[model samples]
Target: IDGEQINLSIWDTAGQEEYDRLRTLSYPGTDVFMFCFSVVKPDSFDNLRDKWLPEIRQHCPEAILMLVGCKNDLRFTLFNKFQNQERKFVTSDEGEYMAAVLGAHGYFEVPSFHHSKVAPIFHEGAREALRRRR
Candidate 1:
């Protein structure tokens, strides 16, 4: 992006149990793995440790892993309007700690509609991929 054009191809795996075996087929050439979870959905974050991390490690141990907390806007909205609601939203501290525990290269929070916020995550992933090549 800094005066250079990078071509990136992304493969999004289905979260369905039926696709679990098929997902590993695309792991071989993956440059970076963006393990994303919604801040508003605590179960998705739990899956990172319970499901995704083990699968990724088994298939692509050398891949650069980045942990992303999505739906930041939802979390903020809920916080402002319904602070006492019995809902769980992930905090930046929790994301950072999990990233550390999972050996992720970085942790980021991104709102769904904020395209600008997502760019740096991919940029970092691409940079890490390139750095690993060297």
Candidate 2:
């Protein structure tokens, strides 16, 4: 990150109800919380507010929060296929707006399958964590 080497460890527990207690245990040393949702699923975006954010705030209040819209490729594909129908996917503008509303450190739309494209998310996250530490 910015010519410095950063050691980052990520614990992605995407709201597993059965391991809610176990998940909270990993929150102690967390520097950044990447709250991710599918762009195709509006309900998942809602979960960021209805479920994830509150939990993260409760456990790690000072942690840097990032709003990530996953499966962005699917959003474009689905939208093209359903062009004549009603568009149900969440828009990029909406994701950015939510990030602002939640006071997230960053907002990213990524296709999980592509490692090259996904690298920025972690790089930016590490940069933010380093910035916060200073």
Candidate 3:
């Protein structure tokens, strides 16, 4: 990234079970794998260790992995809206702990529609890929 032009391609299949078979076909040449889950959805975070991490590792065992908690902006909003009801949101501490347990390269909690926030995830990915290239 330091004076070098890097073309980073991102594929977000959104983990639709209907395309599970087809989705993994694109995993072969992936340099970085960002296993993302919604911060507002504890189930999605649980799926990371139960589903995603295993699937990606099966295909790309030594992949440079990052755990991303998406829709962070909604965490508080959803909690307030559903304040009377019981709900569980994935905490930043849990995300960080999971990343450490998974041996991920990094972990991020990001708001939707913020390019300033999103860019660093890819930037780190690009830098890691570049370093590995050398």
Best by TM-score: 1
Give lDDT for model 3. 0.90
Task: Give the alpha carbon lDDT tens digit for every residue of 1-134 in model 2.
Answer: 88998788877784768988888988998999888899999999999988888998999999999998999999879988999998799889999999999989978998959868778888888988889899
Candidate 1, pairs of clashing residues = none
Per-residue lDDT of 49 in model 2? 89
Of the two candidates 1 and 3, the one with more favorable TM-score, higher being better, is 1
Once fitted onto the true fold, the runs of candidate 1 whose alpha carbons sit more than 4 angstroms away are: 1-6
The clash count for each model shown is: 0, 0, 0
Q: Candidate 3 — which residues are off by over 4 angstroms? A: none
lDDT of each: 0.90, 0.89, 0.90
Arranged by TM-score, best first: 1, 3, 2
Q: What would the TM-scores of all predictions be?
A: 0.92, 0.91, 0.91
Residue-level lDDT tens digits of model 1 in 11-123? 98998899999989988888899998999889999999999999999999998999999988898888878887777788999999999999999999999898899988999
lDDT of 3 by residue, 1-134 (tens): 97789888889875878999999899998889988889988898999899898999899997899999999999889989999999899989999999999999988989977868988888888899889888
Instruction: Give the Å error, residue 66, model 1.
Output: 0.2
Point out where model 2 deviates above 4 Å.
Answer: none
